[model samples]
Target chain A: MLETLPLSLDAVRDVAKECFDDGWRLVTMSANQIDDAHFDVIYHYDKDLTMKHYRLTVPKETVVPSISPVYFAALLVENEIRDQFGICFSDIVLDFGGALYLEEEVRAMPFCKVSVAQKQS
Target chain B: MARTILPFGPQHPVLPEPLHLKLTIENETVVEALPTLGYVHRGLEKLCEIRDFNQMIQIVERVCGICSCLHALCYCEGVEQIMGVEVPRRAKYLRTIWGELHRMHSHLLWLGLFADAFGFESLFMQFWRIRERIMDIMEATCGNRVVVSVNVIGGVRRDLSPEQCQWIEEQLAISEKELKQLSDTILSDYTVKKRTVGVGVLTKEQAYQLGAAGPTLRGSGWAQDVRQTGYAAFGELGFEPIVEYGCDSYARSAVRFRETLQSIDLVRLAIARMPAGETAADVAGAMEDDTPKPVSAGERRDIMQAYNRDKRHRFVTAPPPNLDLPAGHVAAKVKGKPDGEAVTRVEQPRGELLYYIKGNGSKNMERVRIRTPTFANIPPLLAMLPGCELADVPVIVLSIDPCISCTER
Candidate 1:
């Protein structure tokens, strides 16, 4: 009984702004790497204990726009997705430069099954 | 006037966990605070790829020491939902009892730590002294003090006898009376109030906008708790979320203190109303014939391998003959691999703990994403840090009840 609204990468910012203006709280975001080339990212929002999810499929090379300006709480989870999936986010309020949890030398996403060398090449 | 940067923690007198925060201060007032984590990151989520869905229940229990039972409950609930398994009513009530016991102990531990954060030595000892009673209750019921691995996908592994239930009530009565004795000091003492009453104020608007959960949200006058969703036996228990409008550290402390008393009442109610029946649903076909039968060669091999893998039971050399597999052996086997996905939320002592589980009709899960309560509360903690004095940093940090281990996991 999980419901989600399909969203394009371009519509993420607009939906976030709409949710913020209409009194919705940003709950959290979760990302799943579907394959080596694609990832599915979900944004969860809440109002009065009711939750809504907006999901978009992104290519690994795509840079999703940051919603941190609309919801400041999105910064941390966004950085976490960046570190874990290697999905770049643009215009984050506080960018950890992909070192939020990993060291600088740890260049690969630990969550992804592909080897670091395979991912880079 | 130039701002000076001070690095706090990774190791500090006030914090037992390693949470490093860089505080930029002008004179005595903090202008900005930046948190750096990863000190205790164990990459536990990745283990799901190797561990089967059944063993992940024990894995999630290690997420947090204080709320281990609730974590296991949440994971089991998620998997059950995915597989369309209905937990029995008696099992639901049992989960309620153990979950509340964990809440009581976690709050007591936090209260002791909160007291110690402000240099109240004797009060710290007093709170933990009462906490031991609840730990004893858990040990007596579930056989382990902290990580009571009693929750299975279909139901609970352990059941309580009537005598044991009566004994738990007696122990809880003693703990409740002792806790009431410290109420006046914790609520109205001049020093306790001065340090916490107005120290870290988070207004209702700011709290909601920043995604605060549990007591942090309730402490700011929001009647929002995941328990209200009635995942377990709470639906029948007439549960109501506790709210305090003080919007400060003291408000958060009062919320937790009052909740400890609420948990005691809840445990007693769950036991009294528990129905008499089978405690768990027979997910596997093993429950059809309960007679003590000789172990089959294939099943015996599986048991030996299981015993070898389990570190706690590894001392045993071989499987015993005519293994009397008890009733409610729900953990022994599951019908088939779970397919599809489920998102389950449980009300942990800290706040709402969420699990996103996906199974592709395989032993290994496609993904298992955990969103701990501490992760959501960090932004609100950051909002409260600025405009506070340097000496009050620990008071504000402790207010959120940050579990760095849970967060970094």
Candidate 2:
């Protein structure tokens, strides 16, 4: 079962901290492209067997605060989102600076539709 | 002491897949390790935009050759949920049977690899020999040794005959006996213990915080399993999660070793309780006069209309009459494309695999994200790598059973 909670960019850190303090395990984080300019960042957390999904929508250039301080495992997926979607997170503990999975030669934000469209055009 | 940077594998003898780790070592002790990936990345998730939902199953199954069935199963279940298709009970049972068989074969293969990692060549050969029997059973039942494509949306694609089931039972019994002897050797052998027992320790807290799953979490004494969520037929089979408190490589190996036997038991239980019915619901046909009628043009047109309208409709397609689907088994089909999002999680052989799929009421999917077990396991592996001797790197790495294909896919 999943419970989706709407969150703002500012409240994400506090809410994530609360979840972490509540002994919730960080499952993974995903960045889904909603449109050309808007993206939805989902933070998945699990406690016992129930999954809680916190979702916040941000513009393409918005800098989402890093949740790595609350959940260390967040660094990997956060870096991945940065690499694949060009979503930026501030103050990541192990920041790869958008070089986590892709190489330097590969074009950035391969999963973002806008970026792919721009490259194709 | 000067720090030496050791580049471990875009190619390595012990690693079956390509994983490059930049290990900074001081006097043979790894002080820091950084992993660089993408050597085997096929961009499979991105392929979802081009492939329709049906074709995505074939691509997802190839995510990891070892956990192929679980990937297809997870993808199907997610799509089925989105379409709200009720699979037949017998199909669920068959899925459980094949799933456990896959787990058994995967663990046996890992045992062989783990033994080889520690230089136990004889043990490695013995484990692989036992694994071959399981492979033969897979080939005999599913028509392929690896990447068996038995799972489809709403239900499975094939059924096992009574004779085939009995033959599988016999083969499992023989393999179990051989595995019992091998387990004794593994536990008692000093070399195996020396290499695995206290190396790469991960406490329960660390395991949970690191998002470790499957035998890795179980080895650290956590009983969390996605199977506990009762997906597929595991809920009906009285599934129990095997766990160990050692929090070390040996504990992880023992967890996997015991799970192979547990999986065999699961298969036996599934066969004994196998229901008498059809393996799939007709996805594009209707029953008339106690006979399945071909999908009418009107119905097909209605389905197309529904697709254009962005409405969900169920359809049925009957399997070939001569196949194993028992008489009176009806198929439940989805008439149009899925237009919603679903999150499906399945416990693969390695760990908990999650698939996030979003459909847009068209033939093609909008987005698909696969969180493979190995991908989740990488952070924990990095945590384990540091503070260990350079020589123990391969053993510790293999202890997690990193599947680069799954990770990069």
Candidate 3:
């Protein structure tokens, strides 16, 4: 099991800055739907093959601060989460605007377990 | 000069897969590059919800053809770790052998494609020709060339015999000799160096900052290879991550070139030290029809012709006649459904392939997030592309060994 430090939506950037200052390479972020109303966005970091994880349990309606400003590598993965989970992120460096993998006409989160109607609400 | 947006690929002649980049160019030099993905996004991560955990092995293998064995190995290792299953010693060595063979072939294929990208047709053919020997070894040993589905939940489904090991060593000897013959052309030739040496340079800082993996990172003087993490038999095999300090396309190609020979040596080491034991745990069955049918003269000629005509010809050899376990026995015996999470990382030919698996104590897994090496290398590719010439774009892109199928998956 992955042992992750829990973070609120507001603490994502501060924790990411700490990781950057400590010479951690941003490996990748994995986002999975915890429930109909919450998504667990896990930020994985690595330095010298040792990994440290920070997970933010984000509510569906909340807009999480993007960590791409601290680590430029986080932009692509953050955009990917937005495309797959219907979660919004603010101030991504290269914001694909949720079009990284989804077409504008396709108004569905293909990765979500809940119904599209329920997610939009 | 007015800036122009030159769209490169989605269907460019140089790209082996569809990856479009909108390059902002001013007077033949790229000022900026913005990539556009999603031409082939299949949403394979979503399949974990529908397919059972056992069935997802085959699906994950399809994520990338060149490094398919590593994909299966990574997924199986994750599932096994989650279930707390200890894979057998021999099975670990077997996985290492097959995984390195996949790396060898994948590197050779990329070298051939990189040659083709720069218009070196004969050099391209030469690399592919050498790669065919590895393919033949795979076909004879594991029944398929590209997607050799030998990995199971707890261990491997296939075991190498003494005779097969000897034959593989002989084949590797020939490939190594031929590869050394072409090293001058690949590494020091005037034309090859003219195009590759200083093109698309990425410093160690840029590579690490932008999250490069495998040869891309190593090419930039960072010896970061997940294989050093000691997955499978790598810890026992005396492995070292190959590093080249050129920080250019040449360095990346050189890293892969040197790694091909290293993989051959690693396979030899694994075969010599492989312990004799059951290939898989909890496997119980008898030998059933483990014979190879004799091919007639006409069929042999036709097979040879098709194989020579096109490398992608599906060489329809008989399936490997190993492991005669009952259909449902292997799955049923591995204990209950997985209830924990596992973060598995394997060094693929392209780079580090990561899998984040979470199970909900059900048949289907809750989440299987694959962070492919190509996916991590894209940001580095973007960093390298901005200062290169339009003519050098293909070389710079292929230097990263982009696998669009794996990236999109």
Using DockQ as the measure, the top candidate is 3
Among all windows of 10 consecutive residues in model 1 chain A, the one with the lowest summed lDDT is A112-121
Worst 10 residues of 3 chain B by lDDT: B283-292
The RMSD of every model to the true structure, in order and in angstroms, is 6.3, 8.9, 7.7
- Pick by lDDT: 2 or 3, better one: 3
Q: How high is the lDDT of residue A5 in model 3?
A: 81
- Deviation in angstroms for B115 in model 2? 0.4
Per-model fnat list: 0.71, 0.53, 0.80
Candidate 3 residue-wise lDDT, B250-306, digit = tens: 999999999999999999999999999777875222223323345457754655533
Task: Encode model 1's per-residue lDDT on B1-409: one tens digit a residue.
Answer: 9999999898988787899999999999999999998999898888888788778988889989889999999988888887778889999999999999999999999999999999898999999999998998888788799999999878898888787788889989999999999999899999999999998999999999999999999999999998888998999999999999999999999999999999999999999999987677756421222233453577546655333565575545643222223444444346677777778888999998988887777777888888999999999999999999999999999999999999878
Q: In model 3, which regions exceed 4 Å deviation?
A: A116-121, B283-332
Higher-scoring candidate on DockQ, 2 or 3: 3
Assess each prediction's global lDDT (C-alpha) against the native: 0.88, 0.85, 0.88
Q: For model 3, what is the alpha-carbon lDDT of residue B161?
A: 72
Please list, in the order the candidates appear, how each scores on TM-score for chain B only: 0.89, 0.88, 0.89
Give the residue spans of candidate 2 off by over 4 A.
A1-3, A116-121, B282-334
Error of 3 at B2 (Å): 0.9
